[model samples]
Target: MGCTDSKDNLTPEELAIMNGELSLMYQAYQASDVDLVYRKYSNDGIININQWQNVSSKLKLAAYSAPMPPKIQKFYDSLKAENKYKLRDLLVIGIYLSTGKSIDKARLLFEAYDENDAKVLSKGDIQQMTSFIVEVAVEKTCVLIQDDDPNNVQPEEMAKFLQKLRTVKNKGKQELCKMFLGGNPALTELTMEKFVENVTMPSTVQLLTFQGVRKFIKKQEVTASKFAALTSLKKPTGPSDPKAELPKAK
Candidate 1:
């Protein structure tokens, strides 16, 4: 009838064995031996299997978005006109142009449902997704200039903001400053129109914008998991495999 501490449940020998086993398991997990981690932990209620699967999937998708090699680019350019226009095909091409990565790689960045699945991506999906990303991106830049204020950023404030971004190359930073501030001695303020007009590299802007948007999306209570699920497209079979190519133009 005596109470015993949890540690007291195990003998010294049993505790030593458990400690040693846990150490090895920790090492394996740290090393990212996913297979081993899953094999050992899957049955234990301690593992969040869905989360682990998602993390693994995202990592794989990240690899796909990496820059495409020259060979892949050349092959992509040679695809027939018809093959070039399919939704998935166009997405690959768009990603290639945007990120300089092969479609196979870029495909991982979006949702990966079966092409045959009736859940075709709508124009609304594309528009909403792109708008969400760009808005988030622009909002982030706004935050850098003025913390959470909805008012337009002043010229001097914009200049100081750009100056502080010294980590960016001098040429690029100056260009960005000029773009945002314009070249007029009398210029007093930076407007949203000027901001949009001066964005020299829309692609770069979009990419940077996507990064911020992704974080924001992930933080939203309701949309967080939904966004992740949306981006989870069916995995591309292979970059160069013809069999994996999007259906030829109708």
Candidate 2:
């Protein structure tokens, strides 16, 4: 409800943030937009055992097993061992997993921002959630590159960049979470005017373009041998260029 607040008085920058067009924004910020099956499940805080079971089942079955966040794993283990818990707990667990935070951290966050006894997940939760996701993203990128080839320059460069980014504190993370919360409907006791006021400052927005993804790999980081190998692969050239082709009819 808060996310769709009237845009009549908002500035262009704020509008763009809420419109979900920011370059560096994470897909996780728009989790509900990409046809996730669990998006329909409501997070109201009424204690309901059946609802918790349903939510947990859906989350577990949604994808093939992979390493889950610690909190999520713990939540599942506890649920399996003893099927007694509050739906509120499960809702917080959902946010915890989605935002990539440990259960302890997420629980502490819930205590601070839970609008109504864990009934509502407020906008305050998005900041750390996004920060952790971004931190993890940078770390994962470095790890994957290092695993593939320890000598790769990209990973070293990326690690250095990540460290540099960290030096600025959580400024980037805060901006990202601002955009995330502004775009998402996870707010309580927060005013659109207040959000617009804070987000109006264009200087704070951080775009994680990473050479717009394509150039980051192909042009900037790809080894000559790898580039050559990629170029050598058979691929569709699409329709012939009309100007390069012989005149159809002489």
Best by TM-score: 2
Model 1, 1-250: lDDT tens digits are 0011255553332233223222211222222233333334333222243433443343342212337334333333343243322233223222222322222222322331123333333333333334433332322222222222233445565545334332232333233233334333245443333433333244323232223222223234234346668889778667877766679788
RMSD of candidates 1 onward, in order: 29.6, 19.4
TM-score of each: 0.22, 0.30
> Where does candidate 1 have its weakest 10-residue lDDT segment?
23-32
Assess candidate 1 and give its TM-score to the true structure.
0.22
Residue pairs with backbone overlap in model 1: 64-105, 110-231, 111-231, 111-232, 111-233, 112-232, 112-233, 112-234, 113-234
Best-fitting candidate, scored by lDDT? 2
lDDT of 2 by residue, 1-250 (tens): 0222255653332333232222212224322321133334544433344554454455443212354434334424453325444333333333322323222323333343444554444465555445544453333222223123323345455555546445433544554565545645455434433443333333312222211111222222335446679899988676567577666885
lDDT agreement of model 2 with the native:
0.38
Candidate 2 TM-score, C-alpha based: 0.30
How many steric clashes does model 1 contain?
Answer: 9
